[model samples]
Target: MKKLAITCALLSGMVVSQVWADAASDLKSRLDKVSSFHASFTQKVTDGSGNAVQDGQGDLWVKRPNLFNWHMTQPDESVLVSDGKTLWFYNPFVEQATATWLKDATSNTPFMLIARNQSSDWQQYNIKQNGDDFVLTPKSGQRQPQAVHDQRRSGRHYPSVQRRRAG
Candidate 1:
C-alpha cells in the first residue's frame, strides 16, 4: 500500500509538471522566433484600491541576446536602455540617468523574458494564462505583477509586454 501511494504521488507530480506551463509555451513560441521587435505601450499605475495614480505611454524596442530601448513620452519622459551588458535609466524631468548592471535590473523583472529567450529565464517565474495574457509571478512569491501579452502573431511584431507593479 505504501509503495502504491508513493508511486501515485510521483506520477501526479510528473503529470502536473508537464501541464504546468500552460502559458509558458504559448509565450515562448510566440516570442522565440523573433530576432528584433518593437511595440508601443500604455501603462496605468494604481493603488491597492485600483485607483489610477499615474499613466504613461511608451515605445519599446528590443533585440535578442539583451538589447532594448524603452522610451516613455506621455505624462513625463524617461528612457531605459540595455545593450547586452549595462542597463541605463534616464529621467529627463529629474535630469538624472542611472546605470546598473544588466543582470541586476532583469534579475526578477519579466523584461528578462523578452530580453533573454532561454528556458532558464522562464524557469524562475510561474506563468499562468490569465484571460488573453499571462501573469508572470516570481516563484519566490514576490508581489511584482507582470503581464506578457501574447497577441496574435504577425511577423516580427509580437504583443507588447505590459506590467503593473503593486503599490
Candidate 2:
C-alpha cells in the first residue's frame, strides 16, 4: 500500500509538471509571434474581504524584449515606462517621477513577464491553461506574492478583470 501511494504521488507530480511545461512552451511561442501591441483597460482592485479599494482605466503599449509604456488616466494619473533598460514611473498628481533599472521592476510586475520573451523569466511562475486562457501564478518564495491571479486569456497575459488585495 505504501509503494502504491508513493507511485501515485510520483505519477501525479509528473503529470502536473508536464502540463506546466506545455503551457510554458505555448506561452513562449505566443510571445515570440508578437512584437508589440496596444490595449485599453479598466482595472478594479479589491481588498481581502472583496471590497473595492481602487478603480482605474489605462492605455498600455508593450514592445517585445522589454519595453512598455503604461499610462493611467483615471482615478488620478500616472505613467510607467521601461526603455528596455531603465524603468521610469511618473505621477502627475504628485508631480513625482522615479527611475530604476528594468531588472528591479520585473520582479514584482506581472506585465513585465508578458513584455519579456525569454522562457527563463517565466520559470518563476506556474502556468496553467483553461481553454484559450492561461493563468500564470507566481510560485512560492517570491519577493511579494499577490493573492489574486487574473484569469485572463493569454491576450498578452493581462486579464480584463483584475482584483488585488491591499497589503
How displaced is residue 95 in candidate 1, in Å? 1.8
Candidate 1 lDDT by residue in tens digits, 33-138: 7778888888876664566778889898888989999999998899999988999999999899999998877777787777787777888887877666887778
Candidate 2 local distance difference test against the native: 0.71
Best by lDDT: 1
Task: Write model 2 residue lDDT over 1-167, tens digit each, in one string.
Answer: 99999999999999999998997777666656668777788877777576778989999888887898989999888999999999999999889999999887677445655687565667677877766556566775444323323334564444332545645
Q: At residue 54, what lDDT does model 2 achieve?
A: 92
151, model 1: CA deviation in Å?
2.2
lDDT at position 6, candidate 2: 100
- C-alpha lDDT of all candidate models, in order: 0.79, 0.71
Over 4 Å off, model 2: 48-52, 143-163
Looking at model 2, report the run of 10 residues with the lowest lDDT sum: 143-152
